[model samples]
Target: MEMERLDRRGLWMAVGAFVLWGVMPLYWHLLKAVPSLQIIAHRIVWSTLLVAGWLFWKYGRGWLRETLAHPRAAWMLALSGGLIAFNWGLYIWAVNAGHVVETSLGYFINPLLNVVLGVVVLKERLNRVQWTSVAIATGGVLWLTANYGSFPWIALSLAASFGAYGLIRKLVGVPPVRGLGVESLYLVLPALALLLWGETHGEGGFVAHGGVAAWGWIAGALLVFGGVLTALPLIGFADAVKRIPYSMVGVLQYIAPTLQLLCGVLVLGEAFDRDRAIGFGFIWLALALYAGDGLLRGRTAASAAAVDT
Candidate 1:
C-alpha cells in the first residue's frame, strides 16, 4: 500500500511536469513580441540566478566546488550547456514564429532519435522490433519531407540538439541538479552580455524605450517569472524519476508532445491538414510498436527471474 501510494504521488508529479512542458508554448507565445535571442538571454540569466541561489542556500558556499569535484565536470557541463542553450533558443523561435506544431513534431521525434543516438554513439543494439519501429519512424520523416511541401528543419534541429545534450549528460553521468547548476553558471556571462547589448541597442524586450512603456508591467513580470517556469518543472521531473520506474517515465513522456500538439491545433489554431496527419500516423504507429515490444520484454524478463528465484 505504501509503495502504491508513493507511485501515485510520483505519477502525479510526472504528470504535472509534462503538463507544464506541454503548455509552455503558450508561455513563449506570450512573449512573441520579444526577440528570441533576448528572451533566451532572460531565461538563461534569470534561471542561473534562481538555480544558483537555491543551490547556495541548500548546500552552502562550497556547493559549487563540490559539484566540480569531478575533473571533467566543468568541461562536460559546458558542452551540454551549449547544446541546451541552442535548443532553448531555437525552440523559442519556433514557438513564437507560429511553428508550434513543428516544435511538437520535434519532441515527438526526440525519443526515437535517442535510440539512434544509442546505436551510433553508445554501441547499443536494438532488436528487430526496435529496428522496425525506427525504420517506420524514418519513413514518417521522409513522408513529411516529401509531401509536406517543406523540410521540417525546425523539428529535426530541435530533436538533434536535445539528443546531443542527452548524450553528453549520459556520458558524464552527473546528478541532474548539480549538472543544471553548473550548466546555467557557464551560460550566465554570455547571457548577461547579450541582455546588455540588447538594452543598449534599443531592441531589448525587458524595458520600454524612453517614456514609451511598451512592454508594460505584466510582460516584465512574465519575463522574470520565466526562470521559475523553466526550472520548477525540471526539478519536479527529476524528483518524479527518483520515485518511479523508468518504463513508467518513458510511457508518460509522450504526454508532453501530445499536449503540445493539442495546444497548437486547438488553442493556437495552427494548421493540421491531412498530409501532416498521415505522417504523424506513421510515427505514432512506430511508437506503439516500440513501446509494446518494451513491455513484452520487460514482462518476460520479470517472469523468468521469478521462476529462477
Candidate 2:
C-alpha cells in the first residue's frame, strides 16, 4: 500500500511536469525577439551541454562509455535525436511564425495520433468508444483542412514526428535522463557542423552582433536552460510512467496543447475563424470520447484484474 501511494505521488509529479511543459509558450515568448532557427539551434547546443554535464556528474564517465558501447542503442538514440531536433525546430518555427495556435492544435490531436500509432504499429485493439473517438478526431482534422483548402501539414508533421518519437522511446529501454543524454550527444555533431558552416558561409554564426555578447548570451542561456528545463519534465514523466498508466498520461498531455492553443488565439492574436471554431468543437468532442473510452477501459481492466486475483 505504501509503495502504491508513493507511485501515485510520483504520477502526480509527472502530471505536474507535463503541465510545466504545456506552459512552454510562455518561455518561448520571452525569446520571441530571437529568430526561430537561431532559437532552435541554441536549444540543441545548450541542451546538449547541460545534459552532458549532468550525466557526467550523476553517472560518471562510465555512463557515457556504456551508452556508446551498444551499437543498436546508439542507432536508436541517433534516430531519436534527429527526430526530436526536427520537432524542436518545427515547434520553434511555429511559435515564431505566428502559428502557435496550430502548433497547439497539433498537440491537442497528438493523443489520437498516439492511438493511431498504437493501432498501426503496436497492433493494439481499440474498443467502440476508442474507435468513435478516432473517427471524430479524424473528421475534425479533415474539417480543418477543408476549411483552409490545404492541409495543416506543419501541425500534422509535429504530431506524427512526436508520436513516432514516443513510440521509439517506448521500444528503446534506456533510462530517461541517460537516454536523453545519449540522444543529445548524437545531435551535437550535426549542430556543431551547422554552426561552423553558418559562421563561415551562412551567417557569421553564434555572434548576433559581431561579438559573443549580442545574441550569443541569449543563445547560451537558452542552450543550457532549455536542456535543463526539458530534462526536468522528462524526468518527472519517467517517474510518472513507472507509477501511472499510459492512459493517465495521455489524458494529462492535453493540458499543454490546450494552453498553447489559447496562447495562440488570445495572446498572439491568431485567427480563430468560424471554420476553425467548428473544427475545434469537433476535436473537443473527440477528446471527450477518447477520455471516456480510456476511463471505461481502465475500470474494466481493474475489475477484471480484481476478479483474477
Candidate 3:
C-alpha cells in the first residue's frame, strides 16, 4: 500500500512537471529579444541564488558541507549540471529562434533514449511489446528528422543531455531540492562570470542603464523568474524518478512534447502541415502502445499479488 501510494504521488509529480515543461515555450517566447546566452547565464545565476537562500534558511549553514561531503553525489551533479546547462541554453535558443516544433520533436525522441539507457545502465528489462513500441517510436523520430529540413542537432542535443541528466539524478542518493541546489552551485560562478563579461562588453540583456534595465524592467523580472520556472519542474521530476520506474517516467514525458507541439503550431504559428503531423502521429501511436501495455501489466501484477496474499 505504501509503495502504491508513493507511485501514485510520483505519477502526479511527473505529470505536473511535464505539463509545466510543455507550456514553457510561451515563457521563453516572452524573452525572445534577449540573447540566448545571456538568458542562460541569468537562469543559472538567479536559480543558484534562490535555491541557495532556501537551503541556507532550511539547513541553517553547512548545507554545502553536507552536500559536498558526498563526493560521488557532488561529482555526478557536476556532470548533470553541465548537461542541464547546455540543454537549457539550447532549448531557449531553439524556442526564441522559431524552432519550437523541431524542439518538440527532440523531446519526442527522448523517451526511447531513456528506455534504452535504463535497460543498459540500470538493468531494467522491456518485454516484447515495449521493444515493439521502441521500434515504432524510433521510426517516428527518423521520419521527423528526414522530413524536418535541416539536421536536428538542437533537438538531438537537448534529448541526450536531459536523458542523461535524469538518469544521473535518479541514481544519486540525495533529496531532489538539495541536489538541484548543489547542481546550480556548480555552474553559478561561471554563469556569473559570463553575465559579467556580457555586461562589461555591453552585450548583456539584464544590465541597468541610467537606472533602467536595458530591456525594460519587466524583461528583467521575467529573466529572474526563469530560475523559479526551471527549478520547480526539475525538482518534481527528480522526486518522480526516485519514486517510480525510469521507463515509466520516460513514457510519461510524452505530455511535455505534445503540449509543446501544440504551442508551436497554434500559438507560435509554426508550419505544422501534413508531413510533420504524420510523423508526430507515429510517435503518438508508440506512446499509446507503451503506456497502455504498462498500465495493463501493472493491473495484472496487482491482481496476482492480491490473490497470492
Instruction: List per-prediction Cα lDDT, in the order shown.
Output: 0.79, 0.72, 0.89
* Residues 1-309 of candidate 2: C-alpha lDDT, one tens digit per residue: 477577568667766876876778777776665556666666667777777888898889999788767657788878888888898889887887778878887786676766666667666676777688778877987787778656778888988887777767666767777778888887777777776665665353355544434656675566458766766776676566455544445546677787787877887788888998888788778778777776687589779878999
Candidate 1, residues 143-245, lDDT tens digits: the string is 8767866788998898788767766666665566777888999999999999999888876766775432556776678888998887777666656655665
Q: 1 or 3, which is superior by lDDT?
A: 3
Q: Put down candidate 3 lDDT per residue, 11-66, tens digits, no spaces.
A: 99999999999999999898887778988999888888888889999997788788
Steric collisions counted per model? 0, 2, 0
The TM-score, computed over Cα atoms with residue i paired to residue i, of candidate 3 is: 0.93
> By summed lDDT, which 10 consecutive residues of candidate 1 come out lowest?
245-254
RMSD of each: 3.8, 3.8, 2.2
Error of 1 at 309 (Å): 6.6
TM-score of each: 0.83, 0.81, 0.93
Q: Residue 199: error of model 1 in Å?
A: 3.2
- Give model 2 RMSD, 1 decimal: 3.8
- Off by more than 4 A, model 1: 1-18, 209-215, 235-254, 298-309
